[model samples]
Structures are given as C-alpha cells and as structure tokens.
Target: MEETNLYYKLGGQKAIRAVVEEFYRRMLEDELVNEAFRGIDMDRLRNHQTAFLSYALGGPVEYDGRTLREGHKGLNITSEQYERMIRIMNDTLRTFNVADEDRVKIEAFLRSVKPFVVGQ
Candidate 1:
C-alpha cells in the first residue's frame, strides 16, 4: 500500500482553509495561546497557515511564507505556549473529524517543527 498525503486526506483546499480558520479561532479564544496572536494580521496569518499546513501535510501547494524561525523571531515563545497551540490544533482537527491516524501524523509534523518556532 502507498502512503497517503494529509492534504488530500483533509479534503484539499476548501477543508484546509476551514481548518486554518477554526484553528485560529480556537487559538484566539484560548487564553494560553491568545496572547501570541495579539496585533497580528489574522487574515494573512490564516493564509500563510493554510499554505504552510498544506505544504507540511504533503499537498501540492507551496508555502510562500517566511520560515518558521524567521516568522517567530523575537516572539520569546515558550514550550508551554507551543504545546498549548498544538492542543488547540488537535482539537480543531478533531472537530473537523480527522481520523486518529492522520491527526497523529499532523501533530507529529507540528511537534517536529516546534524547535524552530519556539523561544528566542
């Protein structure tokens, strides 16, 4: 059997965009990660996040956004904040009815990249 890409498993561009929107909504409503989004351009953030997740999830789309390290530079993000965001993302995925196997893969991918996005 061949491995499947999450982007397609996630129902392509439409579903990915919905996931991004829901993820941001969850993040902003949750106190743990809400502060990180203050004064940020949410529309642009959603676009970049959609593209990045699409790319990370093995979609055909390419992310044109800044590297995670460059984007997170000077944020002084903490591991706790990062984990919190992951939790919110998982919740969003669950809400979208993503299968456990796929969600695990997505979470793993996000965690693998955490070092690049966290801390000074």
Candidate 2:
C-alpha cells in the first residue's frame, strides 16, 4: 500500500497551505462554523489550521500551540459538531483533489482525535 504520508512528501508546504486556506475559507462561510468561531481571531485561527494539518501530515513544522483538548476546553463540542468538522475536513481534501490514500490518512487522524476533541 502506498504510504499516506506520500501526500506530504509530494507537495510539502505548498500542498498543506492550499488545503488549510481552502478549509478555513469554507469554515468562514459555513453558518455552523461561523457561529462557533465567533469572537475567535481569524488570523490566529488561520495559523492554527495550517499548523494542525502540517502536524498531522508529517511535515517538518512543529506545532507548539495549546493541546487540542486544552484549546477546545469548555467549548462543549457535541458529537454533531465533531461530525461536522470531519465532514468539513473531508470536503476540504476533496476540494484540493487529494488522493484516496491521503484522504484515508486524514480520516484516520481525525478519528483518533475525535474523542479528545469532542469529549466523548
């Protein structure tokens, strides 16, 4: 099987940058996410988005920001919220024409983080 990290190996920073920018743009226009992001700094959110993808995709960049749980602490994210985020993530990958293997890796990573993120 082709390694999922191949996506990162293939496109490096440029590919990750594209996916994150598109993802955040979509989030900004999404009513659910827009409301969730209310009062959050868009610029910082943008950076976090990129750092997140980079970290997950095995890029050289190291994300030193708050832990996912800590950052989302007290947000009380529901299962629905977690599903929506996963859907958005999949859509974002599709928008960038990510390959199936890479998409699988993304899905796996999201699944791994779901419980922590949603407090399940």
Tens-place lDDT digits, model 1, residues 1-120: 114778888898899999999989888898877888889999999998888887887888867788899999988889999999888989999999999998898899889999999995
Q: Tens-digit lDDT track for model 2 on 70-103?
A: 8888777788877887788789888777777777
Per-residue error for 51 in candidate 1, Å, reads: 0.7
How well does candidate 1 score on lDDT at residue 71? 96
Global CA lDDT computed for model 2: 0.76
Q: Over all chains combined, what TM-score does candidate 2 have? A: 0.85
Clashing pairs in 2: none
Q: CA shift at 119, candidate 1, in angstroms? A: 0.1
- The clash count for each model shown is 0, 0
